[model samples]
Target: MKLSHALAALIIAWFAVFGRIQAVTLEVNQGNSTCIKAELTASFSITYNTSNSTRTVQVPLPDSATVDAGSSSCGLDGNTPWLVAVFGPGHALGLSFSTNGSLYSVANLTLQYNLSDTSVFPEANSSDVVTVVSSSVGIWAPINTTYRCLSSATFGVGGVTVTFSNMRLEAYMPGNDLSPAESVCMADQASTTAPPTTTTSATTTVTPAPTPPGTPERGVYSVNNTNGTACLLAQMGLQLNVSYFSQSQNKTIQELVNVTPNLTSSSGSCEASSATLILTEGRATTLTFTFTLNSTSNKYHLSALTLLANWSDMTAPLSASNTSLNYLRSTKGRSYMCNTEQTLAVVPSFSLNTFKLQVQPFEVTTNQFATAEECQMDQDQMLIPIIVGAALAGLVLIVLIAYLIGRKRSHAGYQTI
Candidate 1:
């Protein structure tokens, strides 16, 4: 019995140390539109480059990865969330979590990234891809990739699988994720500006600057929220950098720092069951949102909206002149507006609400996820193999003990004969 116990213990220890871990399956939903929803297991890693004063987050499938685990919604697996990010602290906090496909070679700070599933409120899960439009700049652990500009930015590569031709490159500054004035450069841009005297007949060649460390992005954005009264608005400063990345050290960069008429204005209110924000800035502005869900389409729609807004930046260190800039712009004359309309959809889903937004309009959405610490090992997972090994070891020990005793008796019988 003692020998059996000893053998069992050895087997238990062997499997515990050497057993292989397997991948767990997750659900993927693409719905009818191209907006993708899928799940995959990912290991979170953070590294800080003391040399460059930057932090690097590498969350791609590990080097040991064999395949993308494959999802049916899209043919192959490894569908990185439309965005990948990691949030940390300081002016560099939010930029730490950005669109480098989990390789955050920008920003300097500790890291954390979370977003609630749009459909489900607080129920969260780890995902391969996350969506965002903000970023930082600095060289990371190892820089790679060549720079290339998209032929066009408006029709960004969007689908289940993300490829060079079918993917998008966006950049933003640290602060609010959905600031109307916060520029998010997702489109291909003209390579260079021509002087009026040097005008040409053909179109301007379109090539981006580069996407290395990264570039700041500026512009406007709005999202319909599941919580009707939670919606808010923001007008950011003009003159921001943008980035476009594909692979390795090469990247495309640009800037909209010269925002025409740089400053603008806005005002926001949340009452009854709805929240409204009137902005006169950047490219697109004017937002009227519903506080309830659409009965026909499980999505929320903007009951009233227009494209107008003041251009301002909230992340700039507050100074006497800047602190009250937004307020001054809001009280401007003519209710400033432009002709072109924005086509972006403000699909109602999950949203972040805060007291700070009660007076202003800037917020973010986060993910809900099963954390690494919370994962439990099922008895059936590795225990089955462990137990089988123990039983085999114990049986061998019993047979060996029996054999020794029998041999001793045979030797004693020979001596008696």
Candidate 2:
């Protein structure tokens, strides 16, 4: 019985080690300084074929994979930089980086694989090379801070599906490892069940049914002062509307897009009397909000907003600025809440819906959201029904008086009718 138990225990331990997906840590450097250091878990779903059947395979990035950041590794201080990781003989992953002023992000993903490697793809009769490319993965952050997305983000391109999770990366920093206080995580990056696409023959193609989009990406974004006192807190679904010139249509076009958490980089900071939140969409768009505290009123309000959008077709970027808006007013110790679904239009190009939104800015005590002040719009909505009820009561009173007077007149001496 003891020997049998030992065998079983060893079997269980082996499975425990091999069952989990492998994670890899990578670092890219520019000469003596580290440009990017990341630890991520990756999984791939690949489709291949044999003489008589089409089969699918699921593979994880191996633990032996290593990033190449040697003498021929990086673009250094160029406008665009890049890095690569070789997992096997012919399997590799590549990333291209882009910088915009003070921010940088991974702009593209390139994955290459070979079918002749039976270790990755079993029972593959033919040798074929597959390459998958995707753009605008949109993992970005400010310089020196780490970019993180612990939730899984899946990307599908052509016949390949890749899922990356538990990712942490810092780019263009002089330091060796990640920083603690400045790390920013991309919010609401929940993974989706991506279906696989396959091919039966050279000319024919079979595509998987596309998954419906999931819930709107929303997160509790906050900022704290240097001394660790909370100062700004916001929760809302952010959206942007912009008008641009379409070169193909030869006309102007207006479009509305969600400021998705997965594709947008967000950051916040606070001072003694002011706070700001910055959101950027890769290198093409940026939105900023500034809030100020009024000590006399003991309230804080959104004081200014700015937006800059750059598209390749336009000769110049679109810019908009507004000041003294005095929006989202709340006491220093309270937050603003609007339970009803209402959209607050900050400018013609920017708006947000207050669905399950409670926000406080400029002062936060005890590290907790204080009492919530109902929005003025919700207050007005509540008053509408009360006003209608009062009007109906008045009309009923008038009708009752008229009926009583008519009865009294008819009963006088019993013959007036």
Candidate 3:
């Protein structure tokens, strides 16, 4: 009867141990304020005080979700908990706890899970409540529940959180930094126009001045002696009839011909009787004459003379004699010498026939004389002077002859007394 009681106690203890191992719980929290729809993950740890038996745990997951176990030896250590890796779409997680233990021994069990699958959450919403339950404890537990999208989880400053919509995350890895957004529009531009151009021109002008007038004119001529005729004598007077653009006019030109006499008898004498010529009106023209006398040949000829006269038919002849117009036989008994002179005159109506007078053999000589008009002006020049001794001798002879006649008359008176 005591063995029976012991066996019954062991069977009751085995059932109680099994019940404790089957208790499990799960919970979730999506920590947000906006509306969100997303999945949740629950991880579990199981603790059991049992011996000689194995327990198995099952954790329910959402459709299309997965479950995986962490290393089994992790559950053996009291501090190392078991892990249930969960993946799913709902806001709740599922966990199952199981263990192996002996009968009639008091056994205690604890369950632990890893809530790692966070991708099932709706990325746009807020946090919501999550519940956990255990059949062995007959209780529902509340945990602070939060949901996270795995793709949107960010790790910062010792914790992890879901990145919100419209919030940009810029991360700096080892190589390059993140870039910022750019701007859109631009500003306006500026404008201008040039001023109008101008042009100008200038002109200049000039002019000039005037002038004046000038003087008058004149002429010249010469006379020459040629042929055997004597040269026109120096101081010989002549008559020229000249006309220039007018009626003919007459003018007296002085004869420059002369003779010098040498007498052998005290009573013998020679004189200049005539040396002149007159021109007739129609017969006075251009002619020239050379008056030279050759006593040895007894020939008297006139040199060809050119006269500046108005008429072409003018002619004249030159003559010389011992008396006024007659030849004297007694003048031949005395020796006579002759010479010539040259003269010039310019009259308004006169012309000159010859321009020069050339006397050849240069030694043939001539003498110059004053004109007959010049000679008549001074009579003292015409008279010859007597010597003082000759005058005294004549006076003495007259006085002596007068005194002898007076003495003869006085002696005849004394004889009568």
Q: By summed lDDT, which 10 consecutive residues of candidate 1 come out lowest?
A: 317-326
lDDT of 3 by residue, 1-417 (tens): 899996577545434422222212221111222111123332232211223443322332323333243321123344322223243323223223212111000011122232322222212133333333221110101111121112211111101111211111111111122123311000000011223535446552322221211111111111223443322222222333243221121222322111111110011111122111211123222122222234664433322122322222212121111111111111211221222222233322332222112222111233221122221212333332445566788999999999999999988886442
Query: On residues 120-185, what C-alpha lDDT tens digit does candidate 2 reach at each position?
Result: 566788788788765444466666667777877676544678888888876776677786635333
User: In candidate 2, residue 171 scores what lDDT?
Assistant: 71
Candidate number achieving the greatest TM-score relative to the actual structure:
2
Best by lDDT: 2
Q: By the lDDT metric, which is better: model 2 or model 3?
A: 2
**Candidate 2 overall Cα lDDT vs. reference?**
0.67
lDDT, candidate 1, 5-113, per-residue tens: 9657755543343233233222222433222221223333333233336443323222222212132222125533322222121100111212223221222122233
RMSD of each: 30.3, 23.8, 82.1
Q: Candidate 3 has what TM-score?
A: 0.17
Cα displacement (Å) at residue 87, model 1 = 24
lDDT of each: 0.28, 0.67, 0.24
Ten contiguous residues minimizing lDDT sum, candidate 2: 185-194
Ranking by TM-score: 2, 1, 3
